[model samples]
Target: MGTINELLVNIEQYRLLGYAAVFLLSFLESLAFVGTVVPGALFVVFAGSLAAKGFFDLGDLFWFAAAGAILGDGVSFRLGRRSTIYFSETNRLFKPSRLARGQEFFARYGGASVLFGRFNGLIRAVVPFVAGVAGMAAGRFYLWNVSGAVAWAASHLVAGYLLGTAWRTVEVWTTRFGALLAALVLVILGVYLLKRFFVRRGRLLLAFAGSLLGSVGEAIITNPDVRTFVAAHPRLCAFLAQRFDRQRFAGLPLTLLGVSFLYVLLLLGGVIEDLLASDPIVAVDTRLDNLLFAFREPTMVKLFLWVSQLGRGTIVVAVALTVCGILALWRRQRYILPFLVTLGGSTATALLGKVAFQRPRPAGVAVYREWSYSFPSGHAVIATALYGFVVYLLWRRTAQWGQRLNIFFAGLVLMLALGFSRLYLGVHFLSDVLGGYLLGLLWLIIGVSFAEWRRAEWGPVSAAVPFRSRAAGAVLLVGLLAFFIRTGMRALPAILPANGAAAATVTVPAAAIAEGLSRNRLPPYTESIAGDKQQPLSLVVAAGNEGALTAALRSGGWLPVEPVSFTTVARAAWQALGGGFPPVAPVAPAFWAGRPNDFGFARPLALAGGKPGREEARFWRTPLRTNGAAVYVGVAERIVGYEWGLFPRLGADLDRARDDLVRSLAGSGVVAVSRKIALSPPMTGETLAGTPFFSDGAAWFVEIRP
Candidate 1:
């Protein structure tokens, strides 16, 4: 908190510099070609966030941003009016074809293009130059440009302000949630990039493989041993050749689909078998359930609930009906039956699996009660079958490979999200979702094969869909969307947890603490998100309340660590780089059971040669209390040095840190009784931060006087 105060004071002292920076970024962002490289909008949004913090005036930021943008566009327009020299076929930044496209867009929309293009990153710079080259009147151009800049500035700043307001609510879960979000983003980006590479180079690679295979085949067929084998089995060879004939519907296409169907069927069976036999997959299910439950926040809960609704029965039925109507109007009658069959088959398969397994929904971790059996997720099944078919249809109709790849990846993302939502909500296990996907894919293969055969028999679809048919399809799509919105709104309340529900607390007798520790009823060590052991619990304190515990620690020269945030983190970085460390520096989080530490404290340590160090402890308020007093489980470690001038390096002796903290508390005159008890077998381990330490596995159980 002191660091935040200092930061605010510094910002106030340099307010003019902040405004100047915002203006410069906005100005550079509006210049043609340069705008493409400048993140002007991002800077303005950050300035708005600062305004929310009360360091800058929101109104002043808006005016500066707007003025900068206006002046920048005016300069770009003037350059365009002077010459076309900058825009040539050879210039990568300002290509002739790109300018031509911008001109075409400007011609189509007139002055309105300026207003709309300001929001589009690709054309925001090009449109204004195109307008000037087309001889648009200066008065008209400035009118549109000023209006666009003002609107753009206002929208970005307001968004940033809203983000700032919500930062407090978001900060608590930022570390864990940020890691999850980053992983998801990387996976999506990798898939998209891979698809692009395939779309661009797939044919050349396939042609090369074909030539290599042809040469190998020629060599094999000419060998005397192979010729003898083929002569000995002419009928077998003929059968194999017939099955691989690509020209016939019952040949290679059917063979490939049949193999895919069998593969998916086997995978689905394996999941079911694993569940029945209680394999390692079931253990994974429990661990993931606890991990996601620990990371749950209200905002994320609501988000996943909204996404889960996309797979609901009402929404799927509405979409199916709408697509059927669309296909009927467009004269694609063959697809309607196959689509319905795929959706219906997937739904039925999910229901049957639920009945066959009779697996109960996850206990204790679910956000809301789900009465249905949980062997296979219905949401996952419907998402795969319905969305997968829709993407396939779109891919067939689209002419561009890029568009087709995009459609495929979009469908993949949606399906994966639906599956994750089920797991996050604790309504389905990992294996259940996987089983659902396999079943859905199996049915989809069958449906697509049937559709393909029908198309081969009936002939290709009509060359074009008429305008009337297209209009009718659009109206039906709009109706479907409206129905979905209304139904989802009604269902959201039922899916979310009740407002009255609170976390349940457990109380244990004080005498049982020793027994609990011995039997491992209480966790013996801190864990990572994946349930790997980190540091051992070496401190256990019983206090009448949090106030008494905090007072005792403060009296022992320990200060509470500040919460991790942008301000505190920046302050820590600055202090670390300058070779001075504060007593209340923000500590990296550690998890116990499934949740992060509830409290952290540190005392500055003097090292040899005037080096800086500290002793830190993190504690969690356990659910088990004794005799109406709160019980805290904690781990203590000494920071002996620094790593990379940022991260703290831990001392090798964990026992010394624990003993020092106990002695300090005893000397504070707040301890009623303190004793060391062996909690677990002595061991050496590494912390989550990769710092190695050894402990005697004994903990000081201190009781604070009431």
Candidate 2:
């Protein structure tokens, strides 16, 4: 295989000859006895790899392979046709058992065997012979032969082509990055398989859900208040009855029990998959961590840092005990079983998964860290069980569908947010969170089902005394609603810049950098100048005065650029629609010093055919200065006219922008000296949308003449 690959790579001049080689090899592989000794699949795959590199067209290769296969089978069929009349089952050349098996296959599958047998390597050779001896019609045999060859050739060739592409991509990425990308591909495949499993078993799974819902409906109808309400309003009761009426509710208990077992199996499957690292859980987890790391800022850090405390070990214990107290106070002896099952089972499950998988947590300074293995995240499991059980309690208490829905979604949101908190705080991978969620949900299902069954067995008890006064409940509800409303209101303004050119600022401790500018000397600046979705600041400078720096940039033909906002973005779109250069383009935030760019500048361009483009640079004035000079770091990239897409998309070419900036500065003669410095190592990374880029990690430093 190595030699073949080397040969294909070295011989681009004779790529046209690959078509003939593919045809001849595929023919020999399909021929009766010769096919057994030949590696036809290997050669066809080589052809595919060649096709990938533009040496041969895959379309022509497929046709040639298919034709060769059909012809080979046809020749085998003729030999059988001539030889059968002269020979018997006792002939030395024909093994009676092999021929009998072929006969049996032919009898069972009829002409279809000709098509299916093509995939069974050894049997494929003999099937054509057996068909000929069986006196199958020549035309019918040819039809199946042609159909099977088409499928076989196309599938094998396509598989080879894809594998070839994957191999090359892995080679390139591994050289630039590491083994992470390769592992990620496996993880992604596993996740895709998981989704497929659910989809394929959707109906079977839905039956379990239907049974659970049916049980809940029965429980509601059995309530005394619900019975009284139905009696009082017969017409309304009838309408509701008609909507839910089903005769299949008779054997629903057994169905529910069966579904509960299936849930156990599914959860077990997830655990096994995770432990084996055969699922995309690990890859998804790593990639998600990388993605979240890209967007980290002090604001988000503070938000999640606070929210994550809800799942702390001390908090979990406190909440669990508090719930036990509430259950005792409510006089619900039966409800205690489910609460215990959910809480206890979740904790145990999480512990077992962690120990079994022995997966390590992501590396970072977490809000709080625990000295334990990190497979199933305890926080995710606890939230799912605790909050999920609360959902069940609310679900049982509320008869109205509207109240039930609100309760369900609220509990769901809380659980999801708790899981996200672990992810954002860099304590857990996505897999660990998912594993914990799955485990908790599994236990929650079994516990809730058992609780319902027990509740049905115990008969109705008198309602518990009110835990709090109606006024207190009202006050609590109002307070929660008000708090959420206020939170939502404040979220937008707190993070966004108030106006263009007002750089985002953060207070730096005076003692943080002894050799650099202190907090008192640091200029207020954002991480990047706000235009074009936060262009990153790649260039930094130290100048004695702001006036000199501004004048130097102006001499270099860099005009101070506008900050991006909703109004500016809209105006730009309007200008583009009218076929003109946009005055302003919105930039997405790129973080530095835990904030966005503080300043922006640009130079206009007119390309061939009067097309419009701009070379823009953004700078963030840092808290650090050199030799008592104010230090500013900036990045430059170019945006051509918007590319038409689902929505108009901005076109960027960073390398081109960098070159343009360099040429402009050199032409202006503003710099006394300029040199390149290796700021970091060469690396390959992708944007959030998966647009890949490579960087050599060089930065240009130009000292401006005072």
> Which number leads on lDDT?
1
TM-score of every prediction relative to native: 0.67, 0.44
Model 1 misplaced stretches (Cα beyond 4 Å): 1-188, 205-224, 273-281, 494-512, 518-520, 545-616, 621-623, 638-652, 689-691
Q: Candidate 2: TM-score?
A: 0.44
> Per-residue lDDT for 100 in model 2?
71
Query: How high is the CA lDDT of each candidate model?
Result: 0.80, 0.63
586-696: candidate 1 lDDT, tens digit per residue: 776677766677788999999899999999998887766677788888988898887657557789999999999999998988888788877778999877655678888
Instruction: Single out the weakest 10-residue window by summed lDDT for candidate 2.
Output: 523-532
